[model samples]
Target: MRLTDMAPGMRLAKDVYDPNGNVLMRSGTVVTERLVKALRSWGIDEVTIEADAEDAASAMLDPKTAAEIRALLDQQFSLSNRDHPVIQALYGLCLERALGNR
Candidate 1:
């Protein structure tokens, strides 16, 4: 079956072929929500789940800032210099205001 047809946790094996029908690699576990969320928290969208295609594709990536973020994440460094702090703070404020601090 095609990658698009498999369920979230299902596994499938078939002859893996490149565009020229040459074996490129073998089957492996597909990307999952946990993996995608990990990437999301890092402000990167490299690993994609079939279900998150639209959101992943439409994500607003700031080229200049994303490059910096990518470098930080790749180096296992910090993002204190980026706007994530403010963005997350605003998100928390909005949620608290909307939900009344559950």
Candidate 2:
């Protein structure tokens, strides 16, 4: 979540930590004007927030799309030994890129 998108009364989904590793704000902390200002002063730009199940699911690749991507990756990597560790890692990265995860 972008700090600019946050509004008063919005609750945090996860704990926020400072660069020093100290807890800045706990999960479920309600956003307030003062807190927003403080976060800005601390150079915080984004934060994780609780997402609905539908929203989370929408961000993930569906099984069919995943399988299609995997098959394509397999074909692309066919010239290399699929069983080789390095090739397998490359395949994983290719799949991630194909699925828009990276």
| Highest TM-score scorer | 2
lDDT of 2: 0.69
lDDT of 2 by residue, 2-100 (tens): 677566776777799999999999998888889989988998886655544213433466877767777877778879998996775566545545665
> For residues 1-102, what per-residue lDDT tens digits would candidate 1 score against the true structure?
223322355322323443466653344545455633543454442221232332232234544544454454435424343357675444333322222212
Runs of candidate 2 with Cα error greater than 4 angstroms are 52-102
The Cα error of candidate 1 at residue 1, in Å, is 2.3
Identify the runs in model 1 with alpha carbons over 4 angstroms from their true place. 28-102
TM-score of each: 0.22, 0.50
Residue 86 displacement in candidate 1 (angstroms): 58
Give each model's whole-structure lDDT.
0.38, 0.69
Error of 2 at 54 (Å): 11
Clashing pairs for model 2 are none
Worst 10 residues of 1 by lDDT: 46-55
